[model samples]
Every structure is written in structure tokens, then in C-alpha cells.
Target: MTRRLMLSYVALALLVLLGLEIPLGYLYARGEESRFAQSIERDASMLAEIAEESIEKGNLTALPELAREYAEDNPGARVVIVDRTGRLLTDSAGTIPTGSTLAGEPDIAAALRNRTTVATSTGTNSADVLAATMPGSSGTTIRGALRVTYPMTTVTDRENRIWAVLALAGACIVTAVALVAFALARWITRPLRTLERATAQLAAGRLDNPPDADSGPPELRRLAAAFTHTATRLQHLLQAQHGFASEASHQLKTPLTSLRLRLENFEPYLDPRAHPSLEETIGEVERLSRMVHGLLALARLENTATTPGPVDADAVLVERATMWEPLAAEQHVTIAITGPAAGRVRAIPGALEQIIDNLLANALRVSPPGTTITLARAPGAGLHVIDQGPGMPEADRERAFDRFWRASDSHHDGTGLGLPIVRHLVHASGGQITLHAAPGGGLDAHVQLRPAGRERRFQTIAVTHAAAGHRR
Candidate 1:
């Protein structure tokens, strides 16, 4: 992130430099060219006036000397004087033949025609030259042209010097800007890094204390304060949950112990005449044991760390089905398994098993004789338990999973916590359970489990139980 920010700053600086330098460079070059052109024109105009005055005085002998002196003063300038008939009269360089006709030169020809002209050439001497001409005198038939050639080397040299200074300044400015940008980036990102570390600690459940809020910028300080508040709230919530679980488990222990003791004391007094009463008492003790086990399982689930590995859904279902098979048989019910037998998923193993047990128990109690309680596993993922009992109406389906929610007319001897336990376990395992009406008949409860490891695909297991409430 710091690197990105630095690069962004550099890009912006470059854009600003280009925006300033391009137009300035162009205007500087153009202004230099314009100044040079104007100087050459002024010199030509002065020379033309001097020639006219010299001719009017009829002193042709001093003209060549005057042109030579002008050329020496200007250093790199070439000057020439020509007649109206396109014949060169005086030349500063002295090499050109005096009688040569200047008609072949485009600028010279335009000047001889009594028109001002300027032209640039690049053959023997690569320089821009300006030539202009006007009538030597107004009344007399005297005509002449003045021409001057100036090299662009001096102009180019000046521009190069200016550009070199600009480059040096730009370099220094860029260096300073880069240093400032890096400092600013660090100032911003340092606090963000600290916040990241704090969040990681929180996720790992190692946040025993809050983060220090005085480390960086103002915005980061505020963020750290917010994180501290959130961590405090989470710590309090976890403590409350643990306290509640502890209190509930302690409260339930006495009734469970009493139920066990009563069953034990009544066992030896059983006779053939009271065998039915003995069996009922034994069933009640078993039910109490199940309730205690469920409560303990729920407490452990709430307190324990989340499991990191994938769970085998089919294996869990098959194992729980086998464990409860005898109980279902004793109750005159037939348990059947359906759907894929082997599917993997992510969940806490014991919690998932308990959830399955609770659902099965609920189905067993409410189902009528000869009706099938189906545990059907969906092929792809999740578990579905369908019982063909008097199917719960749609309105009651929502309330079925609430804690201690027994139907008003329910005849089953239960603590009314079966579905609630199932719901808690499912949630702890990162899954969900929904109770709905079965398509054909009875209550259909669906358990969706979290997706497992990459290589292991999820599959749903369906189990069906046949009701035998009317069996002798």
C-alpha cells in the first residue's frame, strides 16, 4: 500500500511538471525566434535608410566600407546591397563577383521587384535570413535592396542553457516530493497495520486487553478506540454466556439425580403385577439421562473452541442411527436409513450427533403406528428427517424449534427442549435446522451443514423411522 501511494504521488508530480514545462518551453522558444526576427528586420531597415542617404549625397565610394563595418559589428551577419536591375553591387564577404545578377535568388528577385521579402535556407549555411527592400528614393529612378543573414546557433545555445537550469531545479523538487510522499504514506499506513494486528488477535481469541490508541494519526486513534469498545463488548458477552450455561447445568443436576435414585430404589420392588409400572419408571429415568446428556452437550459445545476439520455427515448419521435403533425398537418403531451413506462436511462432531439424536427422539414420540419416520439425506449436502406422523400445520412449524415449545395437545412425555437443543447444536456447528411440513405427510426437519474440505464433497443423509405406537 505504501508503494502504491508513492507511485501515485510520483505520477501526479510528473503530470504537473509536464503541464507546466511543455507550454513554457514552447513559448520560450517562440519568443526567442520572434525577438531574433525583429532585430534582423530593424537592422535591415536601418541599412536601407543609410544607403538612400548615401546615394542622395552621390557618395558611392563610402558604401562598401560602411557595409563592412556593420558586418564586423554584428559578428555573424552577411550583408549585401543590390541595384533595381538585380545586379549585386556591394557584398560584405567580398568573395562574390560584383557583376553577378541576383535575379536567380528568390528573395533577391522579390526585392528587385520593389517588394519586401524574407526567406530561410539550409544548404551551405543552415540559418534563417531575412531580406527586405524599398525604393532607394521617391523621385529619382534609384532602387536598392538590403539583405541580412543571421545564424540560429546563438539562439539555440541560450535555450539549451535555460533548459539545463530548469532540469536541475526539477530534479531537486522531485527528490524533495518523493521524501515527503514516503513520510506521509508511512504516517497513514502505520496505524492501519496496527489495527490489522489487533483484529487478528481478536479473531484468535487472544484479545485479553485492548489496543493502544495513541500510536498514530487522529483518524487511526479514533479507529483504535472503536476497536477497543467492540472488544470490550465481546468479552462481556462471552462471560455472560459462560455464566448462564454454568447456572443452567447446576440447576438441572438435582432433578436428574433424583430421577436416577428413584429408579434404582424402585427396581427391586418390581413384581409381575407391577412390571408395567417398573418399565415406565425405567423409561422415565432413561429420558432424564437423555435430557442431562443434552444439556451437558450443549454447554460443552458453547464453551469449546470451534473444530477446524471437516466432518463426515453420513458417518455421523449412521452412527447415531445405530445407537438409537434399540430405543426405537423398544418403542415399537422401525428406523430406516436413506440417501448417500458417505458424505463429508464441516462441523463439530459431538454437537452434530446430538442434533441428530434430538430430532429422532421428537419424531419417535409424535409419529402414529405403522407410519414411516423418514431420515432422508439430500445427495449433495445436509440432512433431512421426515416423519409421517400427524404433520405439523404450517403455522406451528415456526414455533416447533423454540425452547420448551410443546404443542398444546401433545401427549408425549418430553421436556420440550428437543428441537431447541437441535437448533443450538446445529448453529454451533455452523449449520442450520428448519422444521417444515413434509410433502406427503408429517413434519420434515432439514439440517444444512457447512461445506467441508476441498477434496471432500458434501452429501445429505436421509433416515426414515416407522411408527409402532399401537403395537402390543
Candidate 2:
């Protein structure tokens, strides 16, 4: 992330530099060329005026010497004199032929037409040259023309120097920007990395090494402090849960042992008439044992160390449906299952199965005879358990997951821990369950499971059972 941020910052900076430099360089070059042209024009006009006065006075003897002296004083200028008929009369550099015609030259032709002309050209030395021309006149009659050529080397040199300075300044600015970007990126990302590592350790059940609250930026520091507080609260809650499970198990053990011993001793002397009551008592003891086991399981699940694994929700539902079929049939309840062919969820297999079993048992007990109880998978990765029993009101639904919460005047003999156990197991698996009214007047229990990668197989099974003959 830091690398990405730095790259983005640099890219933006380069774009800004490009936007500023291109137009500025073009304007600078143009202004330099304009100033060079203007200087050449002004010098050419002054030389033309001096020559016209000298010629008018019939000072032909002084003309060549005056031209030579002017050329010597201004080393950067090329001065030439041309007659009315286009002959080159005087040349500053003697290399040119003495009588070369200047008729075809662009600036000279313009001057002969009585128009001052300025033009630019390139020389053999690869330097820019600005040339200007004006006709020599006395009282508006043209005699000859004076032409001056100035090399633009000095202006070119100044531009190069300016460009070099700009390049150095740009380099320094870019370096400073990069350093600031790096420091800011580190300031932002260092705390986030530390928080991420601390979160991983906490999830692994290492409560001893909570993150330091002093680390990171202001927002991250506040988050770290909040996380520390949450961890402390979680530790206390887990300790209390463990203590409750241990006490509850101890409280249940004595009665379970006495009941088991009585059953064993009474079986040899029992008649067929007394067998039903003994069996009923034994069933209640087994149910008690299951509830105690569920409590312990729930306590273990609450610890952060437990991570749920992938399981087939459809398979779990099918298995529980098969196990409870006989009981549902005896109670005169119709059990039907319907859904997609497969669905998978992440959860503890045993705990999930137990939750399904408990919901099935409770539904069968409360449902009227010949009523249809449906167990269907929801549209996504979830289960829906619907029963034709007296539905819970809104208030009851709110408190339904509390331990030992049973509806008023409920006929079924239940420890009232079924819904709470289901809630705990679902929450541990990172899922949720909701209770509502079923269509056609009954209770609906919705259990949503976390979606997993692989598909699961699902097949609906239906069973018809009578209520009077139902056995635990």
C-alpha cells in the first residue's frame, strides 16, 4: 500500500511539472527570437541614415573607412553596402567577391522596393542569424541600402543557461517531494500493520499480549485502545462461562448417577405394567444428560481458539430428519423436507447436528396431530424449520433464546434450554437464527448457516407419525 501511494504521488508530481514546463519553454524561446530581430532592425536603420548623409556630401573617400571602423567596433554584426543597381559595393569580410549582385537576396529586394525588411536565417556555424535592411535616402530619393546581420549566439547561450538552472532546481524539488511522500506513507501504514498482527494473535487466543495503545496514528491508537478493552471484557465473560458449565455439570451428576443405579436395580423386579414409568424416568435422565453435555459444548465453543470447519448442511439436516422419523411417526406428525440438492456451510459438525436435533424434537412435541412439520433449506445457505404449533408472540420471540425460557402453560416437558443452545451453537459458527410466525398459523424457526466453497447434496424425506404412540 505504501509503495502504491508513493508511485501515485510521483506520477501526479511529474504531470504537474510537464504542464508547467512545456508552454514556459516555448514562450521563452519565442521572446528571445523577437528581441534579437528588433535589435538587428534598429541597428540597420541607424547605419543606413549615416551612410546616406555621407554619400550626399560626396564623401566617397570616407565611406570604406567608416564601414571598416563600424565593423571593427561591432564584432557580432555583418555590415554590407549595395548600390542602386544591386552591386555589392563594400563587404565587411573580404572573402566575398567585390562585385557580387545582391538583387536576389530577400531582404535587399524588399529594401529596393522602399520597404524596410527583417528576416532570420541559419549560418554555416549552426547559429541563428537575424538580418534587417533599409534603403539609404536623401529627401525621399533612394541611393543605396544598408544591410546588417547579427548572430543570435548570445541569446541562445542565455536560454541554455536558464534551462540548465531549471533542470537542477526541478531535480532538487523532486527529491524533496519523494522524501516527504516516503515519510508520510510510513507514518500512515506502520500502525495499520501493527494492528493487523495484533488482531491475528488475539484470534489465536493469546489474550496475554494485547496490542499497545500507544502505537500508530491517532485514529489507529484509539482503535487499539478499544480493542484492548473488548479483549478484557471477552476474557471475563469466558471465565464466567467456564465456571457456570463446571457448576452445572457437577449439580446434574448426582441425580443422573442415582437414576442409573435405580434403573439397573429395578429392572430385574419390574413387571410389564411398571416398565412404561421406568422407561419414562430413564428418558428424562438421558435428556438431562444431553442438556448438561450441550452446556459444556457451548462453553468450549465460546473460546476464541475454536475455528469452525466446512460441513454439509443438507447432510446434517437429512441425518437428523431420519433419526427423528420414528418418533414423529408415533406422534401422528407429518415431517417433510424440501430444498436444493446441495449446500455447504462452515461450522462444527457435532454442534450443528445437535441444534437440528433439538429443534426437531421441540417441533414434534408442540405440533398438533396430523399437522405437517416442514424442514427446508432457505434460498441461500440456511435452514428453515416450520411447525403447525401455537406460534410465539413478538414479545416471546425476543426472549426465546434466554436459558430456561418456556412459553406459558407449555404442555411439553422441556428444560427450556433448547433454543438458547441452538442460539449459542449458531453464533459460534458465525451464523444467525431467527424465530417468527409460520404461514397457516404455526411457529417458524430460521437458522442461517455460513456459506462454504463446495456444494452439498440435499434430498427431502417425509414421515407420518401418530402422537399417542410416540416414544422418546
Candidate 3:
């Protein structure tokens, strides 16, 4: 943005300078040429008056001496006298023979025809020359032409100096404009850059810390204020929504408990054949109760602000395997934990546990009898929950992490919120979860976590071994 702004300013300045300087330079050159030509014309006219007397008397002897004297006074000028019949009478430089035909010269031709004339020449002298020719007549009868040739070095030098000055001035102005534009661009875009960074932070879910609105230009200040206002309102609205969910879920448990107690109280009076329906009703009630807890947990997960730290993911896998071992045995399923217990990743405390618990629950639900469920460590601080069950097809796996999504063939006992809750927790803790086909015909639920910096705990085993050796 700053570069564009600065270039725009410089382009405008260049355009203006070009418009002014181009015509000014042309005029300067033309004016210099005109002034030099006019001076030579004036001197030629004066010399023509003197030559008229000498030509009228047909005494051209003194003319050469006069030309020599004129050439002595003006060093770079050539003087020539030519008659009306196109014959040169006397040459100032003494190179051209007297009586040489010279009528082809434009200035001499025009002067012979009774008109004063000026011509610029690039002749044999290796320098441009300005020549002025005037008729020398004895009472309107043309006698000869007085031609004065002056080298254009002085005029050209003056023009060059003028052009140099113009160029220097133009350059200076353009440089000044460039400096001012750069400074102005910096001033203007600095605030805008800050606003851009603040906007990015806001988009990245840093809503609790609003952008600073007190600095920058007035327009940007207003924009920042509006951003802060919108963020604060959104923050409040989300808080209210989550607060309602949390409160509603908490409030629902009491009535649910009371109803369960009442159902238990009525169970004894019911017939034994009716016991199945009663049990089903109790199961539904318990499902509802579990759903309420799930809702509360989901709400809490949404609101949970995770501060990342190192966590032993392998240890988490082992711990979850140990905890769910009894349940797996009852289902005739084996839960196996594999990989190093020292592997670590960055996540919130209990986040890995939450993810493992949800995944283990889902795996246990879908696995068949005598199948093995492997919780293996994947590369790059990741975990894989591999289950040899009726694994999801490609279509169902894509949306498995979506809220309340369940595979079409799966049992209907679950609330279908486990993977979604896990996904939220993993994302909140800067981790990723994906479902892929396992190597041996099962679902591989992959969870890759952000690697944590190695802490002092990583060195503890080495340090302990060293201390033991020293004691021995």
C-alpha cells in the first residue's frame, strides 16, 4: 500500500514536471537561437550600409580590408561580399577565391533578391554557423550582398547551460516530492497496518482482547471502535448462549433425578411382565440424563480457554487403556496400548484425556466381540485409535466429527455427540483429528497434536541414572 501510494505521488509530480519543463526547455533553446541570430543580423545590416558605397563605386579593393578588420574584432565570424549576379567579391577568411559563384547559399540568394535573410549552416567548418545576409544597394539598385557568418558555439553553450539548470531543478523537485511522498505514505499506512494486524487478531478468535482504538487517524479510530464494539457484543451474545445451555443443563438434572427416583419407587408395584417396559423406560431416562451431561460438557468445551503446555500423549493412551480395560473385557474385546510413554505434545491439561475418553467410548460402542482395539502412537506427536469393528465407509467418516452425526448402521443407543465434542477439544488445544481406514480393515481415528518444546522432565531419567551411578 505504501509503495503504491508513493509511486502515485511521484508519478503525478513527474507528469507535472514534464509538462512544465519540456516546453520551457524548447522555448529556451529557440529564444537563445533567435537572440544570437538577431544580433548577427543587426551587425550585418550595419556592414551592408558601409559596403554600399564601395560597391556603387565598383571599388572592391577596400572591402577585403574592411572584412579583415570585422573578422579581427569578432574572432569566430566569416565575412563575404557577393554581387547581385551571384559572384563572390571578397572573402573574409581568404579561402574562397574572389568571383566564386555563391548564389546557391539561401541567405545570399534571398539578399540578392533585395530581402534580408538568416540561415543556419553545418558547413565544412565542423561547427554549426548562423549567417545573416543583407542587400547592399546604391539607392535601390543592388550592388552586392553583405553576409556575416558567426559560429553557433556561444548560443549552443548558453542553451546547454540553461538545459542543465532546468534538469537539475526538475531533478531536485522530483527528489523532494519523492521524499515527501515516502514520509506521507509511512504516516498514513502505519496506522492502517496496525488496524490490519488488529483485525487479523480479531478474526483469529482473540475477542477477549479488543484492538486498541485510541490511536491512529480519526477514520481508523472510528473503524477500530466499531470493530471493538462488534466483537464485544458478539462475545456477550456467545457468553449468554453458552451460559443458558450450561444453566439449563444443570437445572434439568434435578427434575430428571426426581423422575428417576419416582420411577424406581413405582418399579416394585409393577408386574414382572411389565418389568421389561419399565427397564426400557429407565434406560431412556438414563440416556436423557447422560445426554444432559453431554450437553453440559459440550458447552463447557466451547467455553474452555486452553493454555497450551507439554503433555505425555503416550502416557495418556496407556492410562485410558488401563481405565477402559474392564469394559473391553466384558465386551470380549481387547484394548491394546502401543508406543513410547515419553512422547509429548502441546495441549491443555486433561485435553488428551478428554479426546481419548471420547474416542475410546466410540470405539468400544462399534467394535464386535473378540476384536482388538489398538491405541497406537503415530508419527509427529499423534495418536491413532484403531478399532476392528464395522468401520465407517468413506462417506460417513467425512462427517463423523459433525455434531449429532452417527453412522447409518451404528446402534442408536449413543447420543452421537462424542466425536464432535472431541473435535472441539482437540482444536481448542491446537491439535487435529482425522478418520481414515485402518491397515487391517478397521477405522483409524488419527489425532495429530502440536509438538511441545522439550521440558526438564525429558532429562529426568538421564539425571536420575547419573545420580544412581554416583551413589554406587
Give the best candidate by TM-score.
Answer: 3
Encode model 2's per-residue lDDT on 257-375: one tens digit a residue: 78778886897799989988998888778777776766665566655356778777788778888888889889898778887644667776576787777677777876787887777
Q: How far in Å is the alpha carbon of 272 misplaced in model 2? A: 24
TM agreement with the true structure for every prediction: 0.62, 0.60, 0.67
Candidate 1 C-alpha lDDT tens digits along 1-472 = 7888887887888788878877787789879877877887788878877876776676766678878998899887778887667677788988788868887887777766666665555535655444444435445455667687767776777788777767777777788888998998887787677778888777755575466688777888899889889887997898788778667777877887887788778767777688787777777777666666656656665666675457777787778878877887777676777765456766666766766776687777766656555566655664677767666665667676665566665655676566677776677667666665566766666676667767444344333322222110
Report lDDT per candidate: 0.69, 0.72, 0.77
Q: Write the per-residue lDDT of candidate 3 for residues 274-331, one digit (tens) a residue.
A: 9899888888898789888988999987776667788876676677789999998999
Clashing pairs in 3: none
TM-score of 2: 0.60
Residue 296 local lDDT, model 1: 62
Q: Give residue 139's lDDT in candidate 3 (0 to 100).
A: 67
